[model samples]
Target: MFKVIFRVTTEVRNTAGLREIKRAGFIPFMAKREGEEEVYEALYKSNDLEELREAITEAAYFLNKVNRKGGNNFATIYKVNDNYVGKGLGGLLGASLGLKLGGIPGLFIGAIGGLLLGEILDVELNETFVGVYSWPISIEQ
Candidate 1:
């Protein structure tokens, strides 16, 4: 499996934005913080690393597009699990998840499920068995 981590800053609380992400098709693993502004840790998972990367890139693109249209500001950092290597399946799983969700929260939830499913299937826990992706959004002070 492959994991990516990222941090994103937005113009306002992302409750509705997150919901929109979900509607786009990704899964949200966790969310926290509060008040006028907030931050969240999101995850996206896939059986393939390349796919995961593509998905994350897509999410970032979408978020930026949304922010640009609304005149919001955002930033993100994506890191892949260096320890994890690819299998014969390539990075299709991860890529598929990212393509489907198009956002952080959805990616996180999908990753969790993918991880669980991989375990249940007895997929080998190679260095890349797990992937981690995060997004932290904050309102401009």
Candidate 2:
């Protein structure tokens, strides 16, 4: 599965601007101190591979539509890998639980379910660009 994350970031003092972002299909994601500003980040995710690959174009389209209306909205995409420990860990947890509940069949079922959940978690984690500051990246040193 592919995940495309679109992010909008602004200073904490400009939180009121977040309302507009929300209306634009962005959702609150995180906040943190960056230099002199407390940055707030909001994101929108697209799981379709085609959309993910073309996220920049979508961002350009959005900017074209909104900017013409005197909107200052800006968006950017972050790239991240697919592999993470969560998937394997979740599969193991699921298999153990499934084995306890229904032996071989339950193990397989639980593993599949757990793997799906883990995949989602990994995508979200990647969306945050894990291992980086939780703030507006550009503002950081």
Candidate 3:
């Protein structure tokens, strides 16, 4: 298994922002530095290096998009953060694709497409208002 750390920087310190990170399945740690508010430090772990990398990428993408509008404007100042729970979901998905699918190329294309779809669904479902959305729900009988 591979372990990775990601730092998430935001403009303000509040529960709403932290909740977003937590809901995404990340282990969030906050620290208040001189002349700065609370900043979130997130950690992500995966079963493989590739999966960890992919999770970092996905989490970065999600964080960027979430902060793009007008509020938080969080940026990844340091390593990619994926140690949270939602981030784990992304890593698991990548690992599954690698194991069940064919090669790296295929996995890359599939993950990108999946991420796109996830964003669209997040918008189309009108769940973005509450900062919660459905993520590729699967049902088993």
Candidate 4:
């Protein structure tokens, strides 16, 4: 199995895109909003490299279709070597935890720690957000 992460941006109402495509992607784990746009992050897998790419393009198609302004959607094949996206996620989590644990100083420490761990995930485990980062979602009760 090819370990990977899939990501895309969709209309908030259309976040169900990934779930619909492969029926295998994890529910989005992160949501980031920029001004008026939102993106979602998820980690999952496929049979192999080829299968993974197919799922990603399918996700890209879904995301693009629902975009309000004909925006471009994207996906990844299997994984990226650097996996900066994972690092970013780690950084965000670290920062939040740091704030809670030790305030501003801890924030820096947490971010660095998270980033290093993310790097380890990318290298040792070959697990990282294999797709885009320029996108978010939540489950509603």
Candidate number of the best lDDT:
4
Q: Write the per-residue lDDT of candidate 4 for residues 1-141, one digit (tens) a residue.
A: 343334443446544554444454433445555544554455444445656555544555555555522233333334535457778888899989999999999999999999977755664456444444222221111
Ranking by TM-score: 2, 1, 4, 3
Candidate 2: tens digits of C-alpha lDDT, residues 1-141 = 322233333323444443444555555455444443333355445545455434334433443333211112233344445676889989999999999999999999999988978866775676533222122223323
How does each model score on lDDT? Answer: 0.44, 0.50, 0.42, 0.53
* Top TM-score hit: 2
Error of 4 at 96 (Å): 24
Cα displacement (angstroms), candidate 2, residue 121, comes to: 2.2
Prediction RMSDs, each to the true structure: 13.1, 9.2, 17.3, 10.0
TM-score of 1: 0.39
* Candidate 2, pairs of clashing residues: none
TM-score of each: 0.39, 0.42, 0.33, 0.38
Score candidate 3 by lDDT: 0.42
Any idea what lDDT model 4 has?
A: 0.53
Model 2: residues >4 Å from true position, as ranges? 1-55, 58-76, 127-141
Summed over model 4, clashes come to: 3
lDDT per residue for candidate 1 within 12-111, as digits (tens), equals 6556546544443345544554443334334445555566556655665565555612112222323334232332123346446855876666565656
**How should the candidates be ordered by lDDT, best one leading?**
4, 2, 1, 3
